[model samples]
Target chain A: MKAEFAHYKKEELMRMLTIMQTIRTFEEKAGMMYGLRKIGGFCHLYTGQEAVAAGAISSLDLSKDYVVTAYRDHGHALACGMDPKKAMAELFGKVTGCSHGKGGSMHLFDVEHHFFGGNGIVGAQIPVAAGVAFAQQYQGSDGVTLCFFGDGAFHQGAVHETFNLGKIWDLPIVFIIENNQWGMGTNWKKVSAVDDFSVTAGAYGMKGSSCNGLDVLDVRATIEKAVAEARLGRPSLVEARTYRYKGHSMSDPQKYRTREEIDEYRKRDAIQSFRSRLSEEKILSEEEWSALTQRINTQIEEAVAFAEESPEPALSELYTDIYA
Target chain B: MAEMTYREALNRALDEEMARDDRVFLIGEEVGEYDGAYKVSRGLLSKYGPKRVRDTPISELGFTGLGVGAAIAGLRPVVEWMTHNFALLALDQVVNNAAKLRQMSGGQLSVPIVFRGPNGPAEFLAAQHSQALGSYWMHVPGLKVVAPATPADAYGLLKSAIRNDNPVVMLEAELMYAWKGEVSEQEFLVPIGKARIAREGVDVTLITYSKPIRVVEEAADRLAEKGVQAEVIDLRSLRPLDEETIVNSVRKTGRCVVVDEAWPLASPGATIAHLVDSRCFDVLDAPVELVSGEDVPMPYNHTLELAAQPSVEKVIAAVAKVLYREDV
Candidate 1:
């Protein structure tokens, strides 16, 4: 981790903190709404691992670089520039949603912001990301594709196939694994033979590095290097040892792990850690932190109101975009 | 008109399209130096080099999904799936990704990609290789599924597929690859979702596509000799089926017989029969008859394979059955 991130800046650190704070606020509101039975269906929140999306995307040019992630994708979308209101409205199943309410929490797509989607199938985005990178390369554009998945999806065969292809073709693509300890009810160790996912990249002749996802600065710097390498036509991998604060979805009771285990990760929560670091470095005073918190709370409130006032899509729209 | 084999016409279409637009390129297994599995991409590697006419490893899902991504990212990638059988390996990428990306992205991204390959049963390629999954894709909403019956349609439809701003599945017939036909020398485009009447008549309407189209034509010729005027409609595009044409024909003839090289239950035959019955049943004098392949996997024996697929004899029998009471 030290060697991977030797160059770090304060503004970048502040930016990472801001992203994590926004995600934390948005996720907490979403979880509260889910508990109140206001938001229906599947709801996966990115709580313990805010830095993975925030840090990785910070190194990318949102106007050009493409971002694709697994179902646990709210954080990635927010980090890439999707308004919290539109994202929340989407989760609320409102027509004003990012995908016009067609996709919920599991499938968030905002192409205008260069956020491809929040794919549900395991390791499905690996090849899609490579394709995007291939297009960039074929068209002589210096763009890159950053693909993220979970440790559970890492076991999928398509992941390895894409890794090899991305390396061989030297396509500008990055594979990011958010190893959040558990896959639904099962742990990562039981599902995977080799626990070290970074080693998986060596077979494809690409550099693979590991980072502490709880540390926002470390994640930002590491992903910056990975994106740079990919931009040079050399694909790379970054295994972020993070934790999801909520269950796999709103449905899961999280019976596989102990409350104590959850508490242990919560002690090093990414959002809390960043807040503390910012205060310690005098970047933000306690009074300023409170004001920022108040501002984000207002934003969340307006997003919910905007969604509640929005109308549902008409029945005829069901078959509108079957093709372009 | 210029005479050429279906394979040559298809190759010419790709070469011409790629030369016409820098955004258009070919990628798939054995497409570059290997000259494609069927030599359809032969001599393309030397002209375009490895970057444009890329030869991919045996990773259909990877490359196909990459093609979808490339298309969505703004490049026209014509992906070759060695055969329709191999497409099963990449179903998730094609069905879930390529087909749904545009809608899912709120029309922000368009997968201008073509998943093309020789489809349907071919000789003794066995059960795995000979399965016809064209109807399976036609069942999908966002995908434009096109199966050309003649060399002219093959060339024109391919050019349209390349230029379409959506994902298209170009299912060619393996048996019809070497078949010779006359195609226009000038470039042309056949609009998708439109069906053409290969032979116009008044006794009955025969709906078919791909290899079974030939069988339907033969049956039409036989019926013409017997005073039965049968109109044969070769449905070039399956998904956006020209239902108006089939309904109008069935309404006029007062009878219909659907021919397909697939099994009877819920296949293309069933789809057409149901559509006609639901929309134009009152106009029909007799129940719509369907001539379909036997409900069994294609066998290695040439005779057994012929028996398993819908044949000219079977189509003739069905047409005769439909027109039995029409004439003395």
Candidate 2:
């Protein structure tokens, strides 16, 4: 982060840092909890990709703007004003969860905050997010839609088709590609014909840019620019160059990447970097930083307790929400 | 009242809706500037301007997905696919996004959009293009599929579909588009999920809709000449299927012949036969008969395409089979 680029208020910077720490802590706990058999089924932790979700959502107004993401969406949901407790309860598949136990870790839904969905299909939410934006534009609302997807989803035909529509309609949509270098087991170089992702946006006649997803400030600035462009009746694309520390999901043994490579990303840990910078700049005192961590940890613990204590939804609930 | 063809009724509906609401728009290939391939969206561009009445590039998937986005954002979009045959390219957006969004969000959002155009076996369109896949959409939980037969129904149904809160797949028959009927000049809306008894009879009920509504009517007229008073029930909607009309009509006549333009095996006809058999078993004097499109890909040849779909002859045969059943 440049000295002159640091225009954010001290309290705001501290708040952003707390969000990063909270995401990191939450994901770390999720990974451990899943490993310890406390959490079951599929869980994809946003361990290394914390800054990407946290930084981008920091610039968003949750009331109007919407979010639709791929399966690696727990962190995105939490950052988009979803209560960490409900999000965790959702992960626990409890009735108190965000989706009332219907959707597990992959499908955390918080409609009140305008979080459209955590879609399970690859590249599926692109058009859905666009539709939400289309409705907003139709109703004369200036609300924008943030559609999140992985590097893997770039190959899908639906994404390209949606990009064309978004461009033609001049929809207020920011397509955030969390290009964490790898699409599950395949590397970007192997799958994508062009090494640079910003070039793909040019195919759809939309402006595209790349930012360091590991740097929270860089992501925040880039998204701020993209969101502004989208609000002006122009859709834009931002390819965040980040990496995931964990395997694709909780079940994987992570045989695809080397331990040394994981260690490399760990050295530039987003949460640690943001926390250290804020603390060193006197934006956050040591006591305040400790208190933020303590609060987040307590919140996670309480969420776990709530999920554990909550009863399962009745058998009839399965048939209740099928239609209007 | 004014006389209007089914296609003209569709165009009039769009013109009226766009006049009423600025948010209402039409988008598809040949819809604008070209005055629509089937001329269903004629004069809409001149009426609503290019922004609302858009003529999209030949990208059904792209434009349909765009319509989904636009609808979610609050636009009332009437997306025509030239014909439903081309909608296959945009099935991802239609099936995955537009249909699933409301329920996927647990009713947080509503897709108040319409994907409208002619469906069913168009002549010589071959396997890829010719299909009565309204049942495919009916298999989806969140969608509402409406197929209107007459010019009056087309006008009323299109008006209602545009105002619907959920995403609607509206089917118009290509052959029946030019057929004319009386339409009211004032505001008119036909309720969805309801059936209209086109003709009344007593001996047997001929259940059908869309393109086959005409087929069954001709069959009923031909049967009337043979002293067979066959009742004709036109199902306007497939999703919230009008089982009541079919069951009651079958109970009165004690026999049914379900005529569908779609293929056999789990089709609308098969499903209707199942419902009638299950609900009105005791009331039925004879087993329900089904007449459907051939259980094969529609051939490209003109005669083969006609043979592929359920003809008036087939419906007549089905009615006769139910009327004088050896098993009964």
Candidate 3:
């Protein structure tokens, strides 16, 4: 833990904390907006797995590197420093949304930030992420890619194909599995044959590691090596053993897991633990903590206002993007 | 212009495009070391090297999706499926990603890729291999589907497909690859979304594309022997159907017969027949007859397979029905 804290400057750590706080605050407001019937379609919240996105992405050069993630992407999108107003407006199905309201909740894209998308398909984005890495390699760019997927995606064929391709071609990419323990009500332990992805990585001759996901510093420490290896064209896998506090989607009934199990993981909640670390390390005062929370709330309020004021996509847009 | 086989024309087109644009590349199974499954990419590996002329494992979905992603990231990839039959395995990448990305991303992404290889029935490659899958991609809105009937069309259409800023599905015929025709030595691009008047007449309009264009021509010749002048139209582009050319031809000729190597239901021929019936209903002298491959999986036996595909006999019969001349 001392070594982990030494790796990042105070400002960088503070930035990551802000990102985690923003993701938590943004999703909580999004859930409330969903209840008010403002946001429609499937909305998967990133309530519990904030540290994985904040930590793993913090280990990269965000200006040059690319990010592609699964459907539960509000956290990754914010962590990439994409405009929260655009993300909220996308969830609200407005013309000002990231994808102009065409991709709601599940598909946010910012070409400028290199946040490829909030791709909604199951296991579909793996090969695409590999392709993005292929372009960077083809162009001889030093940039590496961060590909995030759920534990459920490991069962897909494309994911296996990508693993083989990653090692064979030595693509500059890190495959991060945000194992939140559930595959849409089905437990990963029940469906997955292996307990850890290290066995799968061994089969493909790729490097693998696991991190204590509740601790943001541990995630950062674990993935930093993986990211360095990726720059040398040696792909690696880093599994963040995290857990979600809420049900899978907005309306999932919590029948699969026990409330005690959910309560157990929440005790080591990422934000709460990080708050303690900041206080213990003398990183910030109690008054500063309150100010940070208040600032995040104000940011969330502005995002909500931007979404509500945004208009619906114009009728002429229906056939516009279909061809280009 | 010089005489060349359909395969040579395609090879020349690929060579020219890869040389023309540094971003253009060829990728598929057996495309590099083995010189392509059908020799269409015969010497591309040697000329373009492994980087531009890539070879991949039999994982169609993986490579195809990679090609789409590469195109989205600003490379023009020509993804070849060994055959359109095997492409069925990668339909998810083609439909869900390639076709939907532009609209789904709300114009932030565009897949400038070309998926090309031999399509439609060829000899006794039976059941799975022998099938015309043009209609599968022609149904997609974001995709541009092209079927080349002549060597010039193959050379020109492929060049255009490689240059177009949209995803194109180029359907080449397996049997016609060795068939020789006049082609330009210099670079040329056949405009997409247009029809060619292969042979002009005033009695009946015989419309077809790809491999079935041969049978349609033979049927037109047979009609001419019986003193019935028949016009033949090769619709090279399937997605953006040239309705004006088709409508004008059928209206002027006052009769129509559509031919295709694919099955009838929901096929390209079915769509064309629908177009003619709806648009040129008042000018038609008879119902638009269709000569399509029998609605069944192609068989292994040579005779049964020939019986299944659009043959000269089938085209002649359909043309005779449209001409209303059973005795003639």
Candidate number with greatest TM-score: 3
The best candidate in terms of lDDT: 3
The best candidate by DockQ is 1
Q: What ranges in model 2 sit over 4 Å off?
A: A1-5, A32-41, A139-141, B325-328
Q: What DockQ, on C-alphas, does every prediction get?
A: 0.75, 0.54, 0.75
RMSD of 3: 1.4
In order of appearance, the predictions have TM-scores of 0.97, 0.94, 0.98
Fnat, 2 decimals, each candidate:
0.67, 0.51, 0.61
lDDT of each: 0.86, 0.83, 0.89
Q: Give all candidate RMSDs, comma-separated.
A: 1.9, 2.4, 1.4
Task: List clashing residue pairs in candidate 2.
Answer: A130-B69, A131-B68, A131-B69, A134-B70, A134-B73, A135-B72, A135-B73, A135-B74, A136-B73, A136-B74
List chain A TM-scores, every candidate, in order.
0.96, 0.97, 0.98
lDDT of 3 by residue, A51-136 (tens): 99999988889776999888898999999988999999999989998889998888888888888887788888888888888888
**Clashing pairs in model 1, backbone N/Cα/C closer than 3 A:** A322-B142
**Chain B in candidate 3 has what TM-score?**
0.99
User: What clash count does candidate 2 reach?
Assistant: 10
Question: What does candidate 1's lDDT look like per residue over B202-293, in tens digits?
Answer: 98999998888878887788778888888999999997899988888888898899998877887887999999999987888778898888
